[model samples]
Target: MPTRTLAGRGRRFAAALLLLAALAVFAHPRIEAAGDALARIDKAALAKLTLDEVEGLRSVLELRASWLVAGPLATLERLARAGIPVEVIDRDPAARWFEVTIGPEPKGDSRRPPLADARGREVPQLAPVPLEQGVWITAAVDQAAGPSTMPGSRVIRVSAAGGPALAVAAQRVIQRVPAARAEVRDDPRIAALAAEVSPDRLRTSVEALQSFQTRDATTTGALSAANFLYDYFRGLGLATRYEDFTFPGTIDGVRVTGLPATNIVVTIPGSVSPDQVVVVGAHYDSFGREQTRVFAPGADDNGSGTAALMEIARLLARGPFDFSVRIVAFGAEEYGLHGSRAHATAARAAGERILAVLNLDMIGYTDRVPEDLDVVVDTASEWLGSRYIAVADKYAPLPIARRLDPLLRASDHAPFWDNGYHAMLGIEDAVLNNPYYHRATDRVETLNFDFAAGVVRATLAVAADLAQPSRAPAPPVGPSARTGFLRSLLSRVKLTELAWSPPSDRAAVGYHVYRSPTPHGTYQRVTGSPVTATSFTDRVTSAADQVAYYVVTAVDGAGRESNYSVEVDDGTIRR
Candidate 1:
């Protein structure tokens, strides 16, 4: 156990607040030594503190939310007890070289060079847990209708590619999450399409993305990645477009221009209601978050998800659907889901009929844990999420686990849920333990293509079912719309309430709203059901949920929906 005197605790809390206040004061990333830290503190007021204790305080300031997890478990406990916000990510294979993750040093903390190993080779995610304290760091898959303790993995097996024996290293934590009922839908059509998901092809895509050097949203690499996706989707004969966006003070605390962030979209028009959309999403951008400038082979973090999107596109072109399916590869996910927010915000404003959003993120690294797949279902997307679990059991039965973690908003899917769109995530583990996650070594070598193939298949089953194969062509004419009212649900943070004038279409029974960050990009609906009234409040989530566009369309009494009326832009930001 670690010790924490009441006075020391108060001092530590004050230090954290000071750090928050000092965020505007600090200009340097590297605090040269203990002296550098003390120079900034008011030592005169803290006569009870020792130089050594102050060094530890400096470490706290430098480390901020990050932790150096290598040393002894005792040391780690002390750091945690100190209100350092540190976490022990994972232990290495041998348990000698522990992998650690330090939280962000306040927004404007100095930009130090990237972390390096003993050889001085800069490796992202490899950092020393500054030995400010003593020794002793504190410490510390599959959907196979597995043990009934976890959800089955989303996948199908066939002629080749059996993955390695799972370590089950991370399953202990997963077991704590209740088992979800898996109902494997025996959709032969889905099986055939899933069988088409190849490990070889998936591997090829990861390799191509890894070749990009870096996919940091603020760098040119992000745009390159977007363009690459745009071309690939276009090559598949899909109508693809780039959903461009901007990052305010969010980009490393500086206003960056030409951040070059965007989400790549491939739109497949619905045969009936072309406006009703089902989104298949994955973030394309990658970053080690290792250093201000670093190489992140995000092969596992998201390369696998992006590859799945590409392969899914190939698979979808083979079939038809009644609902529109838009394949979106988002940008700036590592930088707080910038691209998805812009897209989600616009979708709400336009009142697009979004059936569901299936976000695939970090689906490759199946290194540890036996639990096959973990589906994070928030309160909003429960129905769709439960079906996703059932889809795994029905069509591609695999072990699975479910967690109703509303705050598990680490990926792109959360933004949709925040905006009231039914969305969920298909991930390898609820608490991801890919040692190379957010690291330079997160390369193709560590990826399990066979497992990735399974995740892709699972997504296909659900998306295909939701989209539903269609033999009829879409109606050339859609309903028209007119605006009613739109306002903020909260103060000025982001959430908003909107009301639209009912369309003039006489046959229409209700209205559907569509939103997009831009006027041209394919729009997505934010409502779960058709709004019986002309007024609907748009509940936008704060982090990254900046909505701008709204359009309402009349839904015919026959259930047929119309084209959008004139689009409206909401400049609701008070500041």
Candidate 2:
């Protein structure tokens, strides 16, 4: 039996290599030919082959035509490598998959009927995410679904939740799986801050925003929502401003352009590094089908997100953080992320050091047992996503699904990502789960405020962590720095020793060391985390040829930090 099994495996390996060799000669034959060859592969034989043989076939297809790799070949490769029988999934009715496309808008007669979301509701044909001009094709796979009909595209598997990729209809297919969350690092200070996220207050804000009837960016309701937010932030004794922008585009064939919109911006100053900014934003605009100009009540679509943004702004107002926090309620997001695009463009041009952006969108509806949140990120923003999940694990403790895809750019966070800032979008994981999305029926009545509060608490914790809380003891004083040499058997190294007098406050627990090239320049935290020592020794690398500035701050038991101490410099340069 073993000898026969080896013979059978040897035959399958030889056949797969021969098929790959034949495919390499195509050099861009009719795409249908390649598609037909892939479609005609013997599933039984393919499944019997080892992963190495399957990879050989996949490598040849990728080399001959990389486009095929992202399309049918990707699905085929996944199946052959997983060692699952194609017939098993083919007969299962409960098996389904989801996909979305991101690329140039297809030209001419490309419009198709709206696709069904996870719950089998027909989702609208709006561009699901923010993009320059990419089309959104979100749907479930079945007899009607197959590979993307578009010419040029790439398919990235979302995860291993659903079985193999069913016949999908979009540019990319993502299977939902349990979200990967980071280990909890409980900090009492941040926990206290997150605990203050009031569900009632969140509902109040959502109710107010929804009462406007419509906030279609170009309508009077949008301006009203913006004004309401401006006043709310102003009442918090925070700095607030209005940024007007214009969007040129159309949604659902409505001319949504040439009209002015308002974006409300609030600033929470950082006591330490004011230039290092963290943005927490949500779109205030809403969209509906016909009569949308007057009756689009985007309570869950964005009123939920906007309210969360407002609540966080209110919560963080009492903070004097290590880094600045900028809360923005963006305008005209439904029409193509116009408000965030304008803001991101301006921030990029001005050379702002934005540390991260946490965008809240559609956080109020969930029909599942455990209400979960989805953190959407591209390759560049995965770190931000990880940090968010870590904070959620400790502060919010809800199930979270982390989705990494550049094509999921249908919200305000997309603009910041486009402008090269680290940003992540916190949204509901299930696509089209809200049956009332984009309809006049999308009211606060259909929202779950408790769920919204949980999402906001996670955002608050992340934002607060990035902008270190500054409500601790007074700053350490009498800071002094000295340069020394540590000689080793192999080499001599330069070190900068910094020391400071303890603050008068008895509640102080530890100290944080910061360094800067100039006295008033941005000071970077030198310690990985808070240090309990009064003196810190930093290995001197940049200081080899020039002077450096150092300062110290005190931290309390709750993890709240104080302002910077008096600036001190190495005696190498006169101050």
Candidate 3:
């Protein structure tokens, strides 16, 4: 009987161990690395420190909690224990985590609860712990958790996307956190805070060129401006390029052929969607005769606009965008939009998808008439321009005038519109508004930086919205076997090129080049031998043969052909 009982006890113990293992798997609890770090921290020491002492020590400690999440809670608890009048922030049971705030204790006479519980007794101090201090705490949690637990406080599930509930919770948490004592010097501890707390420096440098004036289109002024723009863009780490367009024109009754018109274009490539483009442009040329020459200081006429465009380019180059932003300072706007017209025509012919165009012209002059005039929208397509205006108005501090103008035509926006694109023009009101209109007095001093900043801010908002990345369109499936083979070959070859090193890593396994008539056409291998070359240069003299698309495939030792390199149409190659 004793032996049987011992065997049964052993079996029961084994079953209990198995049940514990099953429960462990079912719980699937994950204490984050951060939680482990928090566990190691000396909570007792933290509890003993004063608000100022804790903030001062924050810089040296490698705390795992976010300031937005932990600072308020710590401050509230510390102040409360120190006998400072403070409120303790409550936690929502349905929430994944609790936020704590410190603030002054609430005052006023107690009132009986209007709604009684089962006992018909007055609710006692039903208010959630009020963290009335300015500090805020934010705790992130899994979306599945409902609201967290906190007695006498409203329960809310906070989302990471900064939803209304989250914002309210954050506000409550901040109110509980104790306000830091004012310091004489800037605290290095909080230097890493966001721009809201510590604003970022202006990325673009400002240089004043006193008595700066330029001669005619071919003068040093035009070239210096172009060089300055190019260097500025390059300094900001942007990929810069220039396009030269020649046009026949009759200047002062003198027929001129092949008049050189150059445009300095800087491209900020997108990270995800590089195909879409947003262009900001201004004219670099000037007209009007002065001092035995056409002294087109053009400062207000276009220099101001040009300068603003350059500054915008500088800012964009310092940051990343989801879509390409091309800043083009066009030449010869005074000569009837010749440079812009040429660019627009070429882009249309090449099937360029231009999302928007922001044209800046004569944006200087502090006079209230032009500087304060309503931002004009295109009468032809008010919907496109009006939408941008509305967004700007929503975010901008000042009111934006959305009026249609009849006199604003034949500008750079027209050429863009002609190509079936959405375009808008931003210009100071030109109708007897500025007394210094196109005069030498329209210098840098005459320009209102506040107004320029407003315009720039509006432009940035619109451009940023348009340039945001969209879901990539799904590619078609079930293509022919040959097409799939070509695509695979291209992908492999491209990856190899990207991964290849200097001194040529190509072995004698050779490569095979294929050609296709169209993007969706069948591809035929051009050569049978494994082309052992890293690059295949087709020296075909016939223009017809040169117009085909080419892709390269590498072969391995076992005669296995790798996927094709990046697709390229010889005719569409830029360089």
In terms of TM-score, the best-performing candidate is: 2
Candidates' lDDT values, in order?
A: 0.58, 0.65, 0.45
lDDT of 2: 0.65
* lDDT tens per residue, model 3, 430-474: 343666655655555566666666666556555654554222221
What's the candidate order when arranged by decreasing TM-score?
A: 2, 1, 3
Residue pairs clashing, model 2: 129-409, 129-410, 130-409, 130-410, 158-174
Runs of candidate 3 exceeding 4 Å displacement: 1-212, 248-255, 289-294, 405-407, 430-432, 469-575
Which scores higher on TM-score, 1 or 3?
Answer: 1
- Candidate 1 residue 339 Cα shift, in angstroms, is 0.4
Query: Top lDDT: which candidate number?
Result: 2
Ranking by lDDT: 2, 1, 3
Candidate 1: worst 10 consecutive residues by lDDT? Answer: 157-166
Q: Give the Cα error of residue 283 in candidate 3, in Å.
A: 1.3
